[model samples]
Target: MNLTPESKVLIQGFCEFISGTHVAQMQAYGTNLVAGVNPGCGGQELHGLPVFDLVEEVIEQFGVIDTTIICVDPYDVLDAALEAIASHISQIIIITAGVPPLDMVQLLRKAEACETLVIGPNSPGIIVPGKILLGTQPSEFYTPGVVGIVSRSSTLTYEVAYELTKAGLGQSISVSIGSDAIVGSSFLQWLQILDEDETTEAIVLVGQPGGGSEEAAARYIAEAIDKPVIAYIAGRQAPPGKSWRQTGTLATVIGRDPNFGTAQSKLAALKEAEVPVAERPSQIPELLRKEIKIN
Candidate 1:
């Protein structure tokens, strides 16, 4: 079930007041925005797609969905995700942030039980340049190329991609798995997928001040992925002892200590794993050219 230009997508939180603006933007980017689901707003339409009150109804009326991009209220993210999972939706990109950490624990547990792939609980989503968009990433920064980007810093993802695109290093895909401690997806998960992707020759990882997934990804890259990876970790200028609060933040909130997951710690791990680290976004193109001879 590859995410391609033809994949049919459903917007779980479609509405007139909140998601209309971004829904319109997703439509403008040529994403196959096939249907939407908003409980009370069912029987209506957005961007020529029918609206349904339940995932079941959406499936019943419009066939199955390839992916569901969620932009609902923070509190409702778990329920929306559960609905998609129950419906056997393979790919889900959640763009809502600020969900309670405990809520994600339950959501992830269900996703695992159902064998579903969940992308975010606070993310910019995933984009396959010239193909499909599953979240809110600005499509202008992307174009079909060999490099695939996976990031935790939403804004930095755009910056690096724009720089790369401007340098003729257009990307094959760019995905943000959210920087929050208890996100639905992981860097390793996306890395593994990109590693197997024939379209992606190299990978660019963007890390941030929080989470230990970056460090973990470095280990996975060392032992697992065969593709050459270029990395840029943000918040290096940030004070120490700040990040990694969520390497297991929810776990901590649930009464466990997941210490040693800081920004500095993550950097050391990546360097130890031998993934080339970039100091600035502007320098990525040169680094890419150096690593892969793209120039």
Candidate 2:
């Protein structure tokens, strides 16, 4: 499925740390880097691209940008995002910096008010196959295909998509839904999109040991969707009271139970609703093959 035509993206707070990595990967995928924004590095060149002093400067130079990838420091995340919104340079914002929880909440509030489609406070950005690579995912892991992928971890998203592609499956859209607790977008949001896209025949959801997002998506599948969903939840045996490595990995502990119940519960719910929950990562391809053959 094709994304909206407006794919040109501004890389916000581009600096020595992430500029090279992001540019090389995204350029290989055919995305244009409209401009780079960094306060003090305006006149300098990075990887042969001009760096601007601010988001406003970038907008003035490059016109309005449809997307912005925020790769600034955690302390500067909110300020950087506000700058992007003020310039009206981005409708879709992907914040790759991992901000503190309190800071993330503030950012989310501002994001909602601006009506911008924010991807993460701690995400690896997004990839649309031959279109754009907004973050650091290896460009070789993706190709044009029919399965839509949404995941909480960037690494896992890359792994699943790479494995799927190697197994002869391509993705319609692969989104790494940043691990921040209060980040923007949800699996259900993407689910609706994939459900409507004729190219997307199946969906692969990668959930981590955390919040109710997976469970929420499971409920949505149970109630509204008929397409086959294959799910794999990480950190299945995480200890209670300690946050999982990623944001949103919070499960309530009860007595002797270690909250492994959460993932299992969601898996059980999906299975009950007739959505196929993969018992292991290796099973995903075979399951998809079987479903496609049967259908």
- Please give the range of 10 consecutive residues that has the lowest summed lDDT in model 1: 243-252
User: How do the residues 36-130 of candidate 2 rate in per-residue lDDT, one tens digit apiece?
Assistant: 77788998887657888887887777786788878778778788888888876445455554576787677678777877677886777777776
Summarize candidate 1's per-residue lDDT along 114-180 as a digit string, tens digits.
Answer: 8788887778788888877777788888888989999987888899999998999879889988866
lDDT of 1: 0.81
Q: Candidate 2: global Cα-lDDT? A: 0.74
Which candidate ranks first by lDDT, i.e. highest? Answer: 1
Stretches off by above 4 angstroms in model 1 are 15-18, 243-259
> What's the lDDT for residue 72 in model 2?
79
The TM-score of predicted model 2 comes to 0.88
